[model samples]
Target: METTAPIVDRWGGGTCPFDAGWKKVMMWSFIITDGLLFAGFLGGYGYARTMATVWPDQSTVFTLPFIAAMTFVLISSSATMASAVWSAQHGQRAVAVRYVWLTLVGAVLFLGMQAYEWTHLIEAGATLSGNPWGDALFGAYFFVTTGFHGSHVLIGAIVLLVLGINLARGRSTTENVEMAGLYWHFVDLVWVFIFTCFYLL
Candidate 1:
């Protein structure tokens, strides 16, 4: 009788098919799902815009210079987040902590500017139901999309604060800093899309 060979389990418990850490994999999964959520929101906004008899003129409804400043701050935060990750990877914990704090400051500034913008719009009669702008759906879509993105920024800010403290205390790892960078970059990318499709187009 011929002896049978035992088969090897290539994907056993110790294996990672993607060759990435569990934290990175989980963060990527979250990013993908969250990206799809934004895509759906933008798609609906586009459709509603085309169907509406009157969509607000972006120039008339938005302060381009102010929006540009907000964009600059968020993009700067992405850079600082990247620096933090790089510093952590290089074992420069003190520098990493400083970068994390800088990124957090950028987030706070962006949120403050956004709040000021929202207050100005609301005072001008912009709301979920209607607005002084051309189309009513315009107000609904604008608030919903931007608000959702702002909520993500807020969450990112909180995470950054925790990560900063942990880094300073020697409780955080390079991988943890990298994951936070991934999240911050995703938020920045999403804002670019929103700025283009919603504000520019």
Candidate 2:
């Protein structure tokens, strides 16, 4: 086997070290790994759908205009998060705080919309065991993936609230705002794939 020496930059920085910060490198790694986990889930869903003799028609299952609104709301939140990070970077603390607040509003609306969807489905006989629509397994995949994503949204909201408080107290840093924005952006991007694959298809 061939071997190569580790590369180091000026000031003796190694390949894994970040010029930005260690937190950013670590955060990127965590987000990438989480992305793979979600991919595994969606891949399983795709395989199951393909191999099954019968799969639920997504249109009849999730046919609602409000779901599109939910997608739009989350996308808008991502933009707000970007603005928050930008403002924080520019030393505009109040603007950053206000944008983060807007992001939180968007997050709350996303969760509320999901709750509304769940209520409608559950009342129509959708359950973990089975749903009235089609394959029983469809409910499993749908709820598991969607619930996982929703949990991330809820956690993001809590993080935003904490960041908001810190910002108000003049304790939050630009790096802190950027880290939160990364996670929010990842959530929004992942939802696009989920929505396109599960709903639009």
Candidate 3:
């Protein structure tokens, strides 16, 4: 009797071909979904602003200098994240670690500025239930958009901390750094949209 060769199952195999690049693909998928959500929020905010009898003047409602500084901090963090990725790609572990630390510092400063802004706004009588600008939409847009961005910044900080620890322990390789870079870049890219839509225009 001749024995037949055993056939391997693609799905049950130790390494499935589809699973090899699934993580990166999933990240991109998630980013697209999140982009859509943000776009929806922004569209609603725009519509409400246009319809309001007394749309809030951003210049009067927001402290330009403070927000400008915060924006600078966030942009600086993105720069550091880019540096970190570059260093990792070139196999400079120490340089990558240092840049990551700088990035975390910038993240912390940005969060602090945001906290200060929120408190200042609340003290000035701007709340989800009330609007200082006479149009309720102002408060609603402020809370929803900034709150969402704040949450992203918080998550980015946590991820940065984890990546920093791993790098210090020699556990994170170049590929791991690159993976973290994807997340860092995404956060930065989202901020660009937020700044443009909410602050600039």
Candidate 4:
């Protein structure tokens, strides 16, 4: 048997908590803070919906099948992003790049579908101020919530494009792909909330 002195001072400079890299820690921090921001948005939307004298019926306003397709595309992108990270970790740079590209394509397709949906709504007189539907706040909340989520998807697409290029050029690391995947997956998860709260409710 060997005797050892009691250890203290977990914050010793040389060690990382949970064995996570600085980049991963930072990404998680960003995800948490960003998630809070979305939570606030949804909270406000929920309160408004409950208080309104007349909330628009979601089914009458949206093409559920088309939105479901968009959701499917976004979820598929998350899977491709996970594949990219896995491939990068396994030293399959070419496969990683390909997966990243596939994920980007899915993001683009989702955005395009969103754009079409928005255009149709606007043409039907939906605006940030009001809509032909019931509650005026319906239009406002719908645009703001989905717009914020769409902007995140757009940013994820840009990041994936740059990541794919760097990966192909041998300038990207497994950690880089992993970070992008984390962000992309967060974007997808947020959409699930938005879809359920705004579209399905």
lDDT of each: 0.92, 0.89, 0.84, 0.92
Worst 10 residues of 2 by lDDT: 1-10
Lowest-sum lDDT 10-residue window in model 4:
1-10
Candidate 4 local Cα displacement, residue 88, angstroms: 0.5
**RMSD, every candidate, angstroms:** 3.7, 2.7, 5.9, 2.7
Model 2 lDDT on a 0 to 1 scale: 0.89
Give per-residue CA lDDT, model 2, range 59-117, as digits (tens): 78786587899999999999999999999999999999999999999999999999999
Task: Compute the lDDT for candidate 4.
Answer: 0.92
Ranking by TM-score: 4, 1, 2, 3
Weakest ten-residue segment in model 1 by summed lDDT: 1-10
User: Positional deviation of 55 in candidate 2, in angstroms?
Assistant: 1.2
* Candidate achieving higher TM-score, 1 or 2: 1
Q: Report the error of model 2 at residue 143, Å.
A: 0.3
- TM-score per prediction, in order, is 0.93, 0.92, 0.86, 0.94
Q: Name the candidate, 1 or 4, with the larger TM-score value.
A: 4
Model 3, 80-193: lDDT tens digits are 999999998898889999999999999899999999999999999999877666787778887888899889889989989999999988898776777777777787788788
Model 3 segments more than 4 A misplaced: 1-20
Badly placed stretches (over 4 Å) of model 1 are 1-14
